[model samples]
Target: MLLEGERDTILKTTSAVLAEHGARREKLIPLLQAVQEQLGYLPKLAMEEIAAALDIPAVEVFGPATFYNSFRLHPPGEHQFKVCMGTACYMIGGQIALDSFERRLQIKPGETTADRRFSLDQVACVGCCSLAPVVVVDNFVEGKVTPTRVDGLILSYESNGQKVEQDSQQTEATNTDEAKGEEGS
Candidate 1:
């Protein structure tokens, strides 16, 4: 369910997009694209608003939205994990790598984590048959990905997040000390 503020924002943005695209059935795809571009993903309320504007059933809008793999229904996470499931990858052990990610992240493919830290997806291929069983982490491809490698990858990212937090806290403390020194001077 969307918060009241989020619902209102979606409604307003959908309204503006409808005004630009008009109520033409031919413009359905482009209209949806425009709305997604603005909002990053299509919320349920935004889709309903779009359907009403086009004078079509909500299911009609949902058909194309769900049909296209490019369209996302939910917001993505900070990190994206794309596991290749092509013939070569599958033969090599892509499924196992994908299973590892699902287990560690506690979210299945096409789903983001509850904390919004990671989103997992399985793609048909990453065009690296030579490097079968590949996993793409935040656009960086890792070849020959195994279950153990997946665990290490997740740990590295988690550690990096903690390091960033600690760095920011240290910077804040330094700024506070400098401010105190200036006040004394």
Candidate 2:
């Protein structure tokens, strides 16, 4: 679904961003983010919407969505899963864990399940290298994950309505604290 309330704000922001860049075609990133924020994913229709709004060609907008790994063409899964493959995570068998997920899910990375319950992708780094071999489901990050841990994560969510990983909550708390600290500083 295209997000409505925030879509206007995003539109305003994109328009302002365009005004700042003097409507140059180079400001595509922010434009794309605005469209993504509105549509949840970049609907093919969004290319037309953005092109008309920005006075650019639809191809101009579509090209980047195809070009960037981060862009989404379809509605994202209800839960987005991100695996970190940073040097530290990889050394700790991150690839093995990812393979386990793919095998079990029967869908490759960068693809969403038919039910849209889960979508998986990889990140080069999430800056949580200390938590080597990590996977983040939705917003919850699982640290120090082993290949053996995959089923537990799946079952934990399946059994508990998908909010199973306690570690992710703790990391989110830490992030909030840091955000507060930054504001105070």
Best by the lDDT measure: 1
Worst 10 residues of 1 by lDDT: 161-170
lDDT of 2 by residue, 116-180 (tens): 77777888888889988989888777788776577666655555544745634544566688899
RMSD of each: 11.0, 11.6
List clash counts for every candidate, in order: 0, 0
lDDT by residue for model 1 (16-75), tens? 999988878899999889989998788888888888887889999999999999998876
Error of 1 at 68 (Å): 2.1
| Residue 158 lDDT in candidate 2 | 53
Q: lDDT of candidate 1? A: 0.83
lDDT of each: 0.83, 0.72
Report the Cα lDDT for residue 99, model 1: 93
TM-score versus the correct structure, for each prediction: 0.77, 0.63
The best candidate by TM-score is 1
